[model samples]
Every structure is written in structure tokens, then in C-alpha cells.
Target: MKVILLERIGKHGHIGDEVSVKDGFARNFLLPTGRALRATEANRKRFERDKDDIEKRNQERREAAAGIASGLNGKTVVIIRQAGETGQLYGSVSSRDVADALIAEGFSVSRSQVDLANPIKNVGVHAVPLHLHAEVAVSINVNVARSEDEAARQAAGEDLTAINYDDEANEAFAAEQQAATADLDTSEE
Candidate 1:
């Protein structure tokens, strides 16, 4: 389907530009979201008539997004969650969690704006992208860990997931000797 975009849609077209897109995309997303209009003669005339107003609104939104992006970019948020010994999270961190963390930090962000490709299932720092506007994008660090101390350590580049073989072996040996001592006492009694 051919449509006239009302604003800049990444990879599609800029405002007032006629472009071809999937019919489902046009009808379901673009039309419903008011981001575009069907390419018809009357719609073309309407677009030309109201093009300036649409462009002005788009510019205002872009500017606002840019202002927010300047302050939001490269910021870090810490999220504490239960994890296994190997640094795997008991529950994965979703987009909503990241949005909430950002909100706690006094940033006005939504889950839709957070472009997380997949839920984070490990404890570490992750760079998450935020699509603030059609033209404005920025990234912030998400520090996921089991505790605040772990988060700090992760931020400082410590690998909490590494297993210490010497400690484990020493612990096992101590446990075996304690068990043997208990058994000898029981036999004597």
C-alpha cells in the first residue's frame, strides 16, 4: 500500500513523502497511530494543505526528544534481582523493569521507548537503547545484579560469576572431616 507519512518514519520516508509499505502495516499500525494516511487524491490534497502544521508538530516533538536525550544518554540504572551462583537471574529483566528503573531515576520513559531486543537473564551491565523519537535515539546502561554491592562490583568490572575451585574444594574437605568425626562419636557411644 502507498501512504503519505505525516512524520519521519525510520527507513520508510520523511513527512509528506509518499512511500510503499505493507497493507497490514498501513492499516493496522500507521493509520491507527495517525502516523500516516492512505495515498488517495483527496488525502494528497489534504496532506498538502496541512503539511506545514504536521511538520511543525513533528519538529516540536523532535526538539523535545533531543533535549531529553541529551540528559538521558549514557545514564545508568541499577536493578536488583535474585540470581543463581552462575550469575543467571532467577527471573529475567523485562522492558517494564528497565522503564520503572528509569522512572525512579526521574526520567520520563515508557516501555515502548525502550528497545530491548530480549529480556536480560544474566547479572551484569547492559547497554539498552531508547527510541525517544522517530529521529532521536539514545542508549543507557542497565546494571543488573543480585544486590547493590554486586551491582557496584559489576560496574567496577568484577566478574561475580566466576567460580573459585580452591574454595569449593576446601569446603568439601572440611564437610567430609566433620561428618567422619560425628560418625566416630556415635560408634563410641
Candidate 2:
């Protein structure tokens, strides 16, 4: 289907350009959302009449999206979830969780706007992208950990997985036993 785009679509076409797209795309998204118009003669005439106003609106929307993008970019949101000793979360972090966290931080974002393809299933920092506009996107860090201390360590670039608590406990026990043996020797002397 050939349609006139009302705004710039990334790598697709610019505003006021007539481009060919899939029928399903036009029917399901573009036409229904009013982001595009059918390329019929009458609709083309109508588009010519409203072209200027549409361009102005598109520009305003782009500017607004840019402002929001600036605020969202490079920001991190920490999410604490219970995980086992292996750093695998018992429950995963979904897009809704990220959206809620963003809202908590005073950003008005929807779950659909978060471009996470799947739920996060591990304890680590992830870069999640927010689609502020069709042409504008920004990424923020999402730190997922079992506890606040682990989250803090992750933010500080620490590898929590590399720290073996069992090994540390064994070393402490050995040191205590050796100290006891030394005290026993001193008493015997």
C-alpha cells in the first residue's frame, strides 16, 4: 500500500513522502493511528491542504520527544529481586517492572515504550532502551540484584559472582584452627 507519512519514520521515509508499505502495516498501525493517509487522489488532495499544519505538529512532537529523551538518556534504575547463590532470579524482571521503576523516578513512560524483548533472568546491570519517539530512543541502566548491597556493588562494577563465600568461610576456619594450635604450643612451653 502507498501512503503519505505524517512524520519521519526511521529509515522508512520523511514527512510528506509517499512510500509503499505492507498492507497489514498500513491497516493495523499507520492508518488506524492517523500517522499516515491512503494515497488515493482525494486523500492526496486533502493531505496537500493540511500538509503545513501536519508538518508543524510533527516538528513540535519531535522537539518534545527530544526533551524527554535528554532526561531519559544515561539514567539508571535499580531493581532488587530475590535470587539464589548462583545469581539467577527466582522471578524475572519484565518491562512492566522497568516502567514502574521509571514512574517512581518521575518519568511518564509506558511498558510498551520499553523495548525489552524478554524478561531479565539474572542479577546484573542491563542497558534497557526507551523508545521516546519513532526516531528517538535512549538507553538507561537497569541494575538487578538480590539485595541493596549487591546492587550497590554491581553499580560499582563489582563481580559478585566471582566472590565465593564458601571459600572465604573455609579460609577463616583454617586461620582460627591454626591460631588455636599456636596458643596450645605457647601454653605447653
C-alpha lDDT (0 to 100) for residue 113 of candidate 2? 86
Whole-model lDDT per candidate: 0.94, 0.90
Candidate 1 C-alpha lDDT tens digits along 18-123:
9999999999999999999999999999999998899899999999889989999999899999999998999899999999998888888899999999999998
Q: Please, what are the lDDT tens digits per residue for candidate 2 over residues 1-189? A: 999998777666988899999999999988998989999999889989999999888888778879988998999899999988888899999999999999999898889889999999998999999987887899999999888988999999987755478888999999999999999999999
Work out the TM-score per prediction.
0.86, 0.83
> Which candidate has the highest lDDT of all?
1
Clashing pairs in 2: none
For candidate 2, the per-residue lDDT at 7 reads 79
